[model samples]
Target: MSKRIFITGIGVISAIGKNASETLSSIKTASSGVGEIQYLQTVHKGKFPLCEVKYDNTQLCELANIDPKTRITRTSLLGIIAAQEAWRSAGSPVLGDGRTGVFSGNTVGGMDKTEHFYADFMQDAQSGDIKTMLSHECAESTERIADSLGATGMVSTISTACSSAANTIMLGARMIKHGLLDRAIVGGVDALTKFTVNGFNVLQILDEEYSQPFDENRRGLNLGEGAGFIVLEAEGIAKEEHILAELVGYANSNDAFHQTASSPDGTGAFLAMKGALDVAQIEPSQIDYINVHGTGTPNNDLSEGFAMQRLFGENIPKFSSTKAFTGHTLGASGGVEAVLSVLALQNKIIYPNLRFKTPIAALGGKMIPETALLENQDLTYILSNSFGFGGNTSSLVFKAYK
Candidate 1:
């Protein structure tokens, strides 16, 4: 049998909170971070709601303890902050032994900086600061995080859209299961940029109001920005008391039905969830709760709801999407949700799906999400789903440490 992978630590920075503790407090109190745009300089500033991290670049640098004078992208800064927190939470293990790896995911990369560079470069060929474009690649943030943590093992960056971070966690777990690494830092990050904001706006999926996932009257997703990372260690390598949860299963799939929409029948979603269950050797009924990929978009909620019904049948487990609190964080959603799942397992609490009122008629209006927080429940195995554009879907099964 493959070795078990245990989550030893978690770190996150989102609109709801800046760290794990604050995130938990927000969830417990049903506080949402979605609000009017404040940081990003865009025409949609007052037109659309967003979940920005609430920290400027200089402020983030100070929190991450990086020199303010250093030229860095917001993506890298956010990643460094979350990654450092995860490392410290994991007891600051020595990574110079070369058995630790860093796997991160993001679609935005340093577009926040790249956009500024282009604005000036387009105006004048040599006017834009070249330094601003240094961290433009998707791998730049991942590399920066690895360097910061002194990780020397396999370093990879996955950009499968919204499923990006979940895929990183899956990859890290697989590598450790195969004896490739003893420890892995896996998650994703994305800083809000004019490019992403305008892109989604052009797609007409940005909600003017706070998003309501799985709601019949849901408009669309509210864009958010942040980062989340978790530390995974081989069962034997990590201290028993430090183990937060066990990553029992993970799987990825693609529907190939549309460029930006899931299949009407949820083929990719079902396959991904089923595959994860198969890997974990568990039944669908075994899942206690689900952190669904309910993006508050009509197509996504419908598709994911159908997928869950197909898999769980009449016994669908209690589930909720925390997006209502943090907004649809795009590439960072997977990692952010992953951290939330671990928090749920750790706290035995079910976070509410905010703003949910009426259920979708297509799903018989019976698929109502958890609208109120429930504390001290029996949560064992939780399934978290992250579906991205181009039908890329991923699911992860996290089991409470026994």
Candidate 2:
């Protein structure tokens, strides 16, 4: 029989709050996690607003069930913590032999430690940079997370910039539908590092103040980091445990326009949304809430706004971006946002698009940029978008289990 996939559980560790419930609470209050960089010591600490996780490395290690002396990078440690949440939330299931697997997305894997090791190695080539820092490569985090979760089958990671985790979830659903595996743990994770901080600054797209997405005066993105994961199980398996949230539709498309910028009209974004709707066999009007990939970047907001207008026309469903709460977790953002959307489905909450004062003149204020929709009423289907660097775009549809 053809299998259907469901999000059984979610675990998240973000800057806004450590756990999913806390993150949700912060979102409800529209609490901005933006502040001076507190976790890492950097020269630009107070010059710009960045969302830094409050925990120290020791705290993160304990959460991940790892030894602080092991020297795992922040990226891999973040994945472990969130993946543990996903595994625990699934009743801590011990799958009977090879029925389970894992797929994750991440870009900065163990980079924090790798950079340090590299710097040390440069000073003295005899330094054992490969000891704890060997798995600093992006794929290493995925391998380590799979090991921690005991997922022996088809454990892998995808690194397509920002859309990494969104596509990870999409791939997991497809694998189940094709009988590749019965159940899969899928998500993404990223941790803050000085490398990313300096990189964004070089692009000159980062905001020195709070990030204002979908707002005309918005400066740029505020880099935040965290880990988020979701357990995707075959319908028959998850329904037995009442751990199912139907992953009805999803799609991914590349803009092929720019290395880091979106197309002028969000052509790739449009393709992804349309593809997701088609997969769900639903029309545009049928969508209830949309969790947009609003990065607050000038190019992203303008392009995404244009795409929304072209697709749903006048009746754009209530939509918002959760970046204000967690900031952008890079590869983990998609997984984190996906879990949030499922929460929105289960709770019928439409999170606000924080800092949205004025809409772009081009899109005609199409999005419902308000924080009040989250606590409104019943919701049916939600469309979530995750657009990444390199013109990669992905969208997923989560429907309340009936």
User: What are the lDDT scores of the predictions, listed in order?
Assistant: 0.93, 0.84
Off by over 4 Å in 1: none
Whole-structure CA lDDT of model 2: 0.84
Which model scores highest in lDDT?
A: 1
Candidate 2 per-residue lDDT, tens place, 156-214, comes to 78999889999999999999898888888888988777888898899988988888888
* Residue pairs that clash (backbone atoms under 3 angstroms), model 2: 350-374
Give TM per candidate: 0.99, 0.96
* Candidate 1, pairs of clashing residues: none
